[model samples]
Target: MAKGDDLDPKGLIEESYKIEGISTAECRSIFLDWALSYQGVSAVGIAALLARHGLGTDHHPMTITLREGLLAPHAPKRRGGRRGRVVD
Candidate 1:
């Protein structure tokens, strides 16, 4: 994927390092926002792109979050009836 198409178009990861007192919690929040922004993309692809940009290392919270997001399975939706039931 192109850099412009990345979840972090503004390079927030790089910019975060420059901030004087950025906390891990804040970074985690930012990472979540970035990850959620690109629902159309796969977690693997996103992680790879982030790694290339230097934000996908184990040392970073962003990377950890990305990995967790990738591994987490989607929850199955619950239907209201047992097997099949007519609404009428």
Candidate 2:
């Protein structure tokens, strides 16, 4: 059996704050939007996030990836290899 209880956005935001690639504010805002929009699909669950994404949004949202011109914070920590290494 599963326990159905209230969800806390602040708690989740605090936890996500330790992670890279996003700030706590963005994480929290995105999460809240997901929660409010995906009402019937078990709020605060990972499944809800997928469902919300599939439904789409008003904003022209793009991923925080190379295509969007956002370099990942941890990307530079890795040693360059011959595959895509810069050379003079």
State each candidate's clash count: 0, 0
Q: State the lDDT of candidate 1 residue by residue for 5-65, as single tens digits.
A: 4556656655655566667788777676666665557666566656665543566665555
- The CA-based lDDT of model 2 is what? 0.39
Candidate 1: misplaced stretches above 4 Å?
1-7, 17-21, 53-56, 74-88
lDDT of 1 at 2: 28
TM-score of each: 0.50, 0.26
- Best candidate, lDDT: 1
lDDT string for model 2 (40-65, tens) is 54323543333333234223232221
* C-alpha local distance difference test of each model: 0.61, 0.39
Worst 10 residues of 2 by lDDT: 62-71
